[model samples]
Target chain A: MICVENISKSFNGRAVLRDVSLEMQEGETLAIIGRSGSGKSVLMKHAIGLLQPDKGRVLVDGIDIGRISYRELRTVRRQFGVLFQGGALFDSMSAFDNVAFPIRTFTDSTEQQVRDRVLRCLDLVNLSDVGTKRPSELSGGMIKRVALARAVALEPRYILYDEPTSGLDPHTSTTINNLIKGLADQLDVTSGER
Target chain B: MAALEQRLIRPLYSLGRYALLLSKGFTSLGHFSVYRKNLIVQCGRVGIDSIPIVALAAAFSGAVTTVQTAYQLVSPFIPPSVIGAVVVPSLILELGAIVTGFILAGRVGARIAAELGTMRVTEQIDALEAMGLNSIGYLIVPRIMAGIIMFPVLYVTAVLVGVGGGLAAAVATDVVSTGEFIRGARENYLVFGPMFGLIKSFVFGFVITSISCYMGYYTEGGAEGVGRSTTQAAVISCVYILLSDLVLALVLL
Candidate 1:
């Protein structure tokens, strides 16, 4: 579970999020609906401890993220999978390697195991055939799908999607929505969408 | 009062941020096993990839220095071998490292800044952090290690190529015979010459890598910001390299 309490954030003394509070329980899909520049992404960043609030605290699994050491914060962060607005794929790596990255980093899986898991994640996102493509070569929709594949590669407890379907075509957006729903049900994962 | 505080505070804030970034690069060194692979890849980037340019620059510098020195020593009493003496020490003690430092300040430093700045703007760095990875350990550490390791190797290469170029130019220009040049170099060669150059290269390596990494990592805005960081990285690396060169010469020599 993630709990944000009275969080306030500002940039250059201009307030973005003020007195915001929320809670997300396990196995739930929560959507933060707001227009662009409405701090939806900022709020999501706070929930994952990516940005600390100027005031108030974030609690992950009952431990206050603001009060913990970085090592402890990383331990908390491991429970999350974030799909950033830009897809945030490593430009140097292929789609397959990008998906395999988290798995290989956190697990002592053999090469074969890593490959199998990466392919499965790609399959889940319907990007099984584009694994060898770099992010630069992929279309916007394909990039988002590959990023989604990478996000769920570790089967994280909570997956955060920031404007995942924004700017995508209606067909692609529906495909993404369905994939998100299917992955949530299949993996039994909590989800937060902005 | 407010304006004055802002004027005084901004540079200090940047300094503090730079120092803190360096501290993070050192402090949060994650698994060495992970670093080993990255370090090797970076070595190839900073070392093996840089040889041609360094060699090219060193050769011209040495040839020019030899020709110029030969021109200046127009006296019956001065042996032609004196050109070798002057050229050898100049290349080994100063030109080799300084030239390489300047070249890399533009080449490697700007490249690091652009790469990291792009990552910053693209949210790739945040993505790495979000994944519970030590982004510093993953990105900066290997680059820094490569810089420190490769700079001196390039310096040695520069010194060797520089001396060879000097000898070649001396013979080709009929300024000094090959044997005379070798004799002069052997006679005037000091144990401290190459040592000082090596030391300078190491310091320059750290300056270029750390400053550029700091500039790149903290970059804000977008494409314009990336261009700004890349330019700053190159400019600042060059400035710091020269400044440190003076300090090292004073302290070490």
Candidate 2:
């Protein structure tokens, strides 16, 4: 569960978010609809521990994110998987490695285990055959799917999506929406989507 | 008064931020194998890829130094061996380190800045952070390690090829016989010359790479911002190298 209380943010004295408040219970889906530059991304960043709000506190599972120890913050970070506005894939790595990165970084899994899990995630996102390609080689939509695959690679407890459908076609977008719904049902995870 | 405050305070703020960045970059480091793997790759890129150009520049400097020295010392009172004497000390004590430092400030520094700046604009750095990784440690440390390790090696190469170029020029111009050149090189030679050169190059390596990485890590905007950062990295690295060169010479020599 995540709770955002009276969040306010400003940049150089102009307000972006003013006293916004929200909550998400376990396994719930919260969709935030706002116009462009409406602090949607900033609010999302705060939720995922990426940014801090100027005048409020964000509590993830009842613990204040701002007050956590570094080790605890890292542990909290592992619970999240985020799909950035752009794909944000590592340009140097192949699609397979990008999806496999979390598994490799946090897990002591074997090579076969890593490979199997990476392939499974890729298959889930309909990108099984594109694992060998680098991010530069993939089309924009393919890049988004690869990023989505990477987001869910660790089977994280909470997933966040920011404009995940912008660069994708309607068919692909529907497919992704379906994937998100299915994954939520299967994994029993909470999600925040914009 | 407002403009003065803006100009003055901004740099002070930036300086504080830069120092904080350097400190953050050096701490809470983990993931050894990843760092080691990245270090090896950076070593090849920063060191090996830079040799040909460094050698070429050194050779030109050496050849010209020899020719000019030979031309000026045409009097009977001056021995031909003095050409080697002048060239060897010049290459080791100053020329090799200075030339290699300047070249790499343009080559390696600009490349690092541009690469990191691109990563910044593309949100790759944020992505790395999102994945529970220390992006600075993962990206900057290995490059810094690679730079300090490789610069001295490149400088030594420059000195060797530079001396060879001088020897070759001597043979071509009939300025000094091989035996005379060797004798002159052996005259008044102290281990301190190479020692000083190595020390200067070492510090140069540390400054050029770290400064470049710092500039790139903080880069904003888009492609045009990347170009600006690249130019800034090159120019700043060169300035730091030249300044440090003077400091190193005064302290060491």
List, for all models, the DockQ compared with the true complex: 0.83, 0.66
Q: lDDT at A110 for candidate 1?
A: 96
Writing each residue's lDDT as its tens digit, candidate 1 over A56-159 gives 99998999999998878888889899999989999999999999999988899999999999999999988899989999999999999999999998889999
Listed in order, each prediction's TM-score against the native is: 0.98, 0.96
The interface root mean square deviation of candidate 1 comes to 0.8
State residue B164's C-alpha deviation in candidate 2, in Å.
1.0
Candidate 2 residue lDDT tens string, A19-67: 9999998999889998999989899888867788899989999989988
Query: How high a TM-score does candidate 1 get?
Result: 0.98
Give the residue spans of candidate 1 off by over 4 A: B1-3
Q: Which residue pairs overlap in candidate 2's backbone?
A: none
Give all candidates' CA lDDT scores: 0.92, 0.89
Model 2, B116-235: lDDT tens digits are 999998888888877777788889989998999999999999999999999999999998998898799999577899999999988999999999998899898899999999999999
Clash tally for model 1: 0
